[model samples]
Target: MTSTGTLSRAQGTALCVGAVLGTGVISMPALAADVAGPASLLAWLALIVLSAPLAGTFAALGARYPDGGGVSTYVRLAFGARAAAAVGWCFFFAVPLGAPAAAAFAGGYVADILGGGHTTMVGTFLVILGLVVTMNWFGLRISGRAQLWLTGTLAALLVVTVVAALPHARPANLTPFAPYGWAGVGAAAAVLVWGFAGWEAVSSLSGEYRDPRRDVPRATAAAVLVVGVLYLAVAAASVLVLGPALGDSPAPLADLLAAGVGGPVRVVTAVVAVLLTIGAVNAYLAGASRLGAALARDGALPARPVRTPRRSLMVVTAGSLVSVTLPISLHTSMLLVTGCFTLVYVLGTAAALKLLPPGWARRGAALAFVATLGLLVLNGRPALLSLVVAAAAVAYASRSTSPKIRIPSSSSAGSIAPKPNTNPVESLP
Candidate 1:
C-alpha cells in the first residue's frame, strides 16, 4: 500500500504539546479554584492517566491507516463514511472557534502588559492571528522548534511560581476543598480535559512520523506526563499562595509571581502568557487547516477552495474571528469545545473497540470513553449544547449525498469514479 501523507515524530509531538499547553493553563485555575483548590490536582492526574491509552488507540489507527484525515480517517475505517464526515465536522468547528478564542485571550494578556486598552487588545489579536496565518500559509517549519522553546519557557515559569509560593501556601486555602462538591469537581474536570485534549491530534499525524507505531505513543505518553505534572504544580502553588484570591484573578500565575518577585514580574509573566497563547493559536491553525483539507478531499465538505494556501489562510482567519466573538466566558468556551471534542473521542474510542477484537485493552478503552463522556455531561448546558450540535452534524453528513472517491482493494494508489449506491453515505476504507 502507498502512503498518502507523512509528518516527523518531532512535528507530531510538537502538535500535541502545542494543543495542550495553551492559555487555559493561565485561566482554568481561576475558574475552578472556588470549587476545588489543590484537589483540582486530582483532576489533572486523572486526565493524564486517561489520555495515554486513548492516545495509544489513535497511534494504532494512524500506523495502520496513515491518511491525511486523522481521526475522521480512523472513523471511516471502523464505522463508515458518514460517521467519519461528522467527526471531521465536529473537529473542524471546535478547532476554528478555539483559534479565535486563543487569539483574543493572547491579545487581552498583551494589553495588560502594555498598560491595557481596547484598541491595543483588538489590534494585538488581529496582528497575532495574521502572523500565525501567514506562517501556516507559507508552510513554516519552525513549529517544532517554537514548541520546544515555548514549552521550556512556560515550564520554567510554572516551576518558579511553585517554588517561590511553596513557603506561602496556606492550609486554610485548601480547607473546604470541594465547595461545589463532587458535582463541581466533575464540572471542572470537563473543562480541565481541554488542557489535555490534543494528544490524539498528535496521533493524527502518524503518517508523518519517522516511526509512528512506536514514536507516537511514546511522545503522547511522555508529553502528557510532563504537562500533567506542570499543571498540578502550578495549580497547587496558585491555591497555596493566592488562596481565595485565585478565583478572582484572570492572570493567576502572574499574580502569584508578582507577589513573590515584585511588580516587574508581571510584565515578564504577561509576555510569556501572550507567547503561550500565540503558540497555541499557530498550532491550532495548522491542525484545523489540515483537518479541513482532509475533509474536503473526502467530499464531506462543499467543493470549495480548500487546497490552496490562500484558502487555508482564509479558513484559519475566519475560525479565529469566531473564536474571538463567541459568547460565554473563556472557561466556559474551553469546557464547551472540550465537550464537543470528548464526543469525538467517544466515537473514536468506540470505533477502536469495535474494530479491534474483544480484549482487556478494548474493555479498558471502553470504560475510559464512558467515564469521560459522563464528565462531559457534567460541564452543564453549554457543553451539552455543543455535544447536541455535534450529533446533528454527524447525522446530516452521514445522510447527505456527495461525490466520493473509492479506494480499491489492490495495493495500488489510483482513485476510481463514484458509483451510485442505495446508501447515500460514502465509505473510505
Candidate 2:
C-alpha cells in the first residue's frame, strides 16, 4: 500500500466517495427544493438508483483495462485514438470548470456566514485552488491518504447532522410533496448531476490500486453505498424538517444542524463545507494531473516545455480563477459543471458498450449509455457548449496520429499488456 501506485480498497473507496460528494450536499437540497419542492427527493433517489449501472459500467472497464489513462484508455481500445482524445479532452478540461463551481459554492456559504460578498467568495476560491494544487504537488499517495482522512471526517459529520435532525421531522412535510409537479422532477434531476458525477473519476487511478480487478469494483460498490446513504439522509432531512423553508436555506445543512441541536453548529457545518470542497477538488486534481500526463505521453496532447503534472495543475488553477469571477450564481454555474461530466459519462458508457464482452456486461453498459444520453438531453441548452467542445476535440484528434501505443481491450479477454512506462513527469492519486 505504501508503493507509489498501490492503493488499498479502503483508500480507493475514500477517493471515490470524496470525488462524488462535494459542496453540492450543502446546497443541492435547497436548489432542488426550489425547482421541485419536497419532490426533489425523487431526483435524488433516481440518480442514486441510476448510479449502480453508471458506476458499474465504469468499474468494469477500469477492471478490464487498468491504466493511468483511465477512460481514455477504454475509448482507445474501443474506438481508436481519435475518439479517445476527444473523451480525454472532455475529462481533462472538466476539472478546471468544475473546480470553480465547487470552490465558489463553499465560498458562497462562507460569505453568507462572514459577510464578505464577492470579495470573500473570490478569495476563498483562490485559497482552495492553491491548497489543492499544493497538496497534489507531493504526488498521489499523499493525496490519496489525505482523501481518506477528509472523507472519513466529512462522512462522520454528515451522519451526525442527519441523525440529530431526524427528531424534528414531521409528517406534514410529506403532505405537500410534488407541489411543483412531475416536470420539475426532471429539472431537479439535471441539477443533481453534480452530486452523482464522480464514479468515473477514481477509475483513472485504477492502476494505483494494489489489485485493480479485485479492489476497483469493491471500492466502487462501497462508495455507492456510502454516498447514497449520505445524500438521501440529508435530502430527506432538509425536506421533511425544513419543509417550505428548504428552498431558501442557503446553508441547508447548517440550518438543519442548528434546528436539531441549536447554536453555532451552522458555523461548524460551514467549516465542513470548505473541507469537503478541498477533498473534492483534490481528488479531481489528482486524476486530471495523471490524465494530462498520460495524454501528453500518448501524443494526444502537445509535449509541455515543463513537467506535465505541474503545468496541468497551474493551467487548471489559472482557468478556475478566471471562471470564478464570472457574473453567474453558484447554482447556474453548477448546472454547467453537470453538463461537462454528463458528456464524459456518455462517452464512457458508449465505450463500455463497444468494448465490454457480450451478455450482462454489455447489457448493463447499454443501460448506462441510454440513461446518460437521456440525462444529457435533460441537461438542456447549457449542455450544447460541452457537446460542441467534444466535437471540436474529435475534429482536432482526427488530424493527428500517435504510433504503436496500444491500450488493452476486452476483446483480448482481460490479458493486459505490461503497464506503460508512464513518464516520471506523471503520477496518480
Candidate 3:
C-alpha cells in the first residue's frame, strides 16, 4: 500500500530552507571568522556556487524518483544496490553521530534562556530531545503554516541583526583577507557545507508532492539560493560588526545585536534564536525518520514497526546513547557528519549524471559531480576516512548474497511481476 499525503510547493520549499538554515547560521560565522576571517566570505561564495548545481541534481533526481530514500534511492537507481547501501550506511552513521551534538546545541541555548550550568545543560539536552521525539512520534506535521511562521520569524530576526549592525561596518576588518591562507577558507567551506546539507532532505518527500517533477526542483533551487544569500549577508555582517572578536563568541549575532541595540532587542533576539534552533531540530527529526523508514522498506535495515509513533522515539533513544558515548566534541562531530554528507552528494551528483540522458546538461552535471568530489576530498582526513568506509561497504555488498529488492519499474497498477510457481520434489511411487 502507498501513502497519499505530501507537501505543497511552499511547504517543500520551507522544509528545505529550514533544513539548511539551522543553528549553523548562528554558530558558523564565528568558526568562519576564526579559520578564514574575511576570506571565509570567499569560501561561502565558492560553496554557494558549488552547492547550487549539486542541490539541483538532487532536486532533479528526487523529481524523477519521488520516493522516500532521498540520496540512497537516487544512488541505487543510477549505480546499483551496493552503491546505494554504501550511501545509506554513510547517511545513517552521519545522522546518529551528529544528533547528540545537535541536542547539545539546543541544550546550550536552553541554558542561555533559563540560566544554568553543565548539569542543567545536559538535562535540558535530554529534555529537548525527548520533547522533539515526542512531537514527531505524535505525528506533528510541521505544516506549511508552521514553516511559514518559523521561517518568517527567523528571517526577520536575522534582518533585524543585520540592519542594526550596518552602522558599525568597518572595511578594515576585511584586510588580510586570507589571514590564515586559502587552506583555512577550504576548511571553513567544508564546515559551512554542513549547515547547508539538509536542503536535499526536502526532496526525499517528493513522492508526497502534488506535482513533484515540477515543484521539487524549483523549490529546492529557490531554497538553496535564498539560504546562500542569507548566509553571505550574515557572514559579512559578522565581520563588519564583530571583526576578530566574532571568533571567540558562540552566539556572535546575538551578542553583536545585544551590544549594538541593547534593551528589548536582546531579549527578542534571544527568543528568535531559540526558535531557530527548534526549527532545525524539527527538520532534522522529520527528515531522519523518513529516511529510516525508506531504508527499512528497501530491506536495508531490519524491518521494524516503521511509520509508527515509536520510530522517532527509537531514533531519539539511539541518538542519546551516541551522544553519551562519542569522544568527539559536538562541533567536531558536526563537521565530520558534514564531510560524510558531502561524500554522499558527490555520489548523488554522479548518479544524476548517469541517470540523466547524454546531453549538455548531463555533461554539466558530470563536471559538477567531479568538482564536488574534489571539494569534499579537500577536507583530507575525514573525507578520506568516509571514502574508505564507503569503499568497504560497497565491496561487502557486492560479495553478499542478500535478496535483491527492486522497486517496480512501472507506476501503473498490475506492474508488479508475478512469482513463478515451483513444485516440491515428488516422493518415489
Candidate 4:
C-alpha cells in the first residue's frame, strides 16, 4: 500500500531499455546476417521471444525479493554460497569486456562517418571510456536520468530508420536463406545474445523501484516490447534492405538510413551509435561497480580497492582499459562477454525455478534455463572463459575467508570474517 522510491515507472522502463538494447543493433545485424544471410532473422526472433520469459523471471524475482542483492541473492537462496559467488564473478567481470566491445562498435560507426579509419575508432573508444567512467564516479543517477532522454531518442531513431528503410527491402534477398546452412542460425543466435544481455542487469536496480511488485512487472513488460520491436525492425531491415552487402558494410544502420532517406545519415547514425554506447556502458558500469563493492563486503575481493563504489569504479576502469588494450578481435571479445552473460542467465533462471511459486512461472523458468544453457554451448570455446572466471571466484572465496571470526578488541583486532554468498552482482546498493 505504501510506495517510496526515487525512480518513476518511466525511469525504470528507460533503464531497462538502456540496459537491454545496448550497442548490438549498431553492428550485430550485419555480423549475424553475414553468418546466416536472411536466415539471421530467425536468431533475432528467437532471442527476442526468449527475452520475455527471461526478463519475466528476473522481474518476478526482483519484485518478490526487492533487495539490493538483485540477482546473486536468488542464486544464494536456491543453490549455495559458492554458486552465488560464481554468478557475481561472471557479471562483475563480464561488464569490463562488454564495455570495450560496445565502445568499439560505436567507434566503428564514427570511423565510417568521419573517414579516420582505426584512429577514429580508437579515439571514439577513449572518449566514451572516459565519459562513462566520469559519469559513474559522479553516480549513475545522473546517467540514469540521461538514459530516459537517450532511450527516447534512440527508439525514435530506430523506428525512423526502419520505416524509412522498409521501402527498399527487396524480397529477393531472402531467397537464399541459411546461406551457411541451418547451423548458421545457431551461430547468429549466439551472436545476438549480446544484444539481449541486460534482463538480469535490471534486477540489480529493483530495489530502486517505488513499488517493486507493482512497478517491476509493468516496467519490464514495457521494456520487453520496446526492445523486441526495435531490435527486430533493425535486424530485418539490415538483411532485407542491405542484402548480400551486409557482411562487408561497416555501419549497417547508416547504410540502411542512406538507402531509404538518402542524406548525411552516416553522421546521424554515428551519433546514434555514440549515444547507444554511452547508455549501455553507463548502465553496466553502474551495476558492476556496485557489485564489486558488495564482493568486497562479502570477502570475495581485497577490501582496500573495492570497499566503496568509487574505489570499485577504479577497479572496473582499470580492468576495462586493459581489456580494450589487449590484442583481441572484436568478435572474440564479444563472445567472451556474452558467454559470461549467458552463464549468469543460466544461473539466474535456475534460481527462479526454486524461488518462484509453483505453476507457469516455474515452467517458464525451466524453459529459460534450457534456452540460456543452449546459447552458452553455442558460444563454443569462448564460453569456457565464463567457467574459468567462475571457478576463480569460488577459489578466491575459499582462500580469502578465514574459518574463524574473532571479536575486535578495544583497538583494532579485526579478524577475517567468513564469506556469505549473497549472489552479489545485484548485491550492491
- Maximum-lDDT candidate: 4
Q: Least accurate stretch of 10 residues (summed lDDT) in model 1?
A: 420-429
What digit string (tens of lDDT, one per residue) describes model 3 on residues 1-429? Answer: 232434677777777787788777777888777888888888877877776777777776666667666788778777887887778667765666666665565456556666675665567556656655655554434444466678877887787788888888899888877889888988888777777777556655666566776778788877887788788888888887788888887667677787568764545655665666666666666666666666555555544544322462375458656665767776577767777787887888888787766665466578778877776876667676577668766776666554554544423211111211100011010
Ordered by TM-score, highest first, the candidates read 2, 4, 3, 1
Question: lDDT (CA) for every model shown?
Answer: 0.66, 0.80, 0.67, 0.81
Deviation from native of the Cα of residue 74 in model 4, angstroms: 1.4
lDDT of 2 by residue, 1-429 (tens): 122355788889998998888776887899899989988999999999889888888888887777767888788777888877887887888778788888877887788788898788778888888888887787666777888999999999999999998999987987677888999999999999988888777777887777778888899989989999999999999898899998987788889998899987767987998999998898888778767766766667774621266666676677777776677776667777788788888888999887887877678889888989999999998887677777877777777676556555454324234354333335332
Q: Candidate 3: TM-score? A: 0.86
| C-alpha TM-score for every candidate | 0.85, 0.94, 0.86, 0.91
Runs of candidate 3 with Cα error greater than 4 angstroms are 1-3, 112-114, 140-145, 264-266, 305-313, 358-364, 388-429
User: Whose lDDT is higher: candidate 2's or candidate 3's?
Assistant: 2
**Position 275, candidate 2: lDDT:** 93
Deviation in angstroms for 172 in model 2?
0.8
Q: How well is each residue in 374-427 modelled by candidate 4, as lDDT tens digits?
A: 999999999999999999988987777622322222122111133222222333
What ranges in model 4 sit over 4 Å off?
Answer: 1-5, 402-429
